[model samples]
Target: MSRRAAGVILLAISAFLTGVKYITASIYSTSSPNSGYGADSFKQWLDYVEGNLTTYSMIVLIAGIIYLILAEIDDFDKK
Candidate 1:
């Protein structure tokens, strides 16, 4: 695929991952207040999400940025 296409795909994936992260964070915040769970459990869940999903989101975001830069460079090269 072309650099522009790859960049677009990476950006789309990053956006989706970001949306998921926001939804998960909102769910955790809204539910934590009403739940009878202990603080430790909440902390553990937060840690787990941060370690896994959040990490993937960050990686995807970085990759998207890289792809975008490459696309820009490719455009420049063609000029």
Candidate 2:
């Protein structure tokens, strides 16, 4: 696949993951006791979700930057 296509797909995946994280957090917050205060399970869940989100977001950002650079190079080559 092209850089642009890969970038778009990465962005879409990142967005979807973010949305899912938000929903999960919301649900946990509402159902848990005072937003998982003093709870080991809640802390673990939060940590897991946060780690995944951060990893995916970083991947998306890096892919997007690479895509932009590739596009710029293509443009320069044409000029």
Candidate 3:
């Protein structure tokens, strides 16, 4: 696949992952008030999500952007 296509795919995947992260967080957060058991559980969940999904989403987003930029530069150089 072309760099542009790869970049678009990566960006779409990153966006979907981010949306899932936020939606899951919101759903969990609203299910119970943040206190005692609920608060602790939420904290743990947040930590896990931030460590894994959030990290990967950011990396993918950045990589996608970088790929687009590089593709543009390559096109510019060609011209």
Candidate 4:
């Protein structure tokens, strides 16, 4: 519908994703080598995620920004 509405929706999605990322990264993570930082297993993705708070935030922000940019581009192309 409107750019404002789309922006708000994107922001909400970003916030949700970012919150999940942070919660799993911080509270759900561990410090022991047998837990979050073991020398093997796929659970390390969780630890990696925990170590990249800024990255997750940037991803969220990038999503909103990409939406904004696409909206602007569409408007420009419509001219």
Best model number under lDDT: 3
Q: Write one digit per residue (lDDT tens) for candidate 4, span 1-79.
A: 7764676677787777677765665544454455544444335545576556657666767777777888888889999
- For all predicted structures, in order, the TM-scores are 0.63, 0.61, 0.72, 0.44
Model 2's TM-score against the true structure: 0.61
lDDT of 2 by residue, 17-63 (tens): 77777667656756866445456765566665686777787788778
Clashing pairs in 3: none
Candidate number achieving the greatest TM-score relative to the actual structure? 3
What TM-score does prediction 4 earn? Answer: 0.44
Estimate, for each residue in 1-79, the C-alpha lDDT of model 3 and write its tens digit: 8899989999999999988886776566666565335666766656656657888899999999999999999889999
lDDT of 3: 0.81
Q: Which ranges in model 2 have alpha carbons more than 4 Å from their true place?
A: 33-48
lDDT ranking of the models: 3, 1, 2, 4
Q: How far is each candidate from the true structure, as Cα RMSD in Å?
A: 4.1, 4.2, 3.7, 6.7
Model 4 pairs in collision: none
Error of 3 at 25 (Å): 1.2
On TM-score, the stronger of 2 and 3 is 3
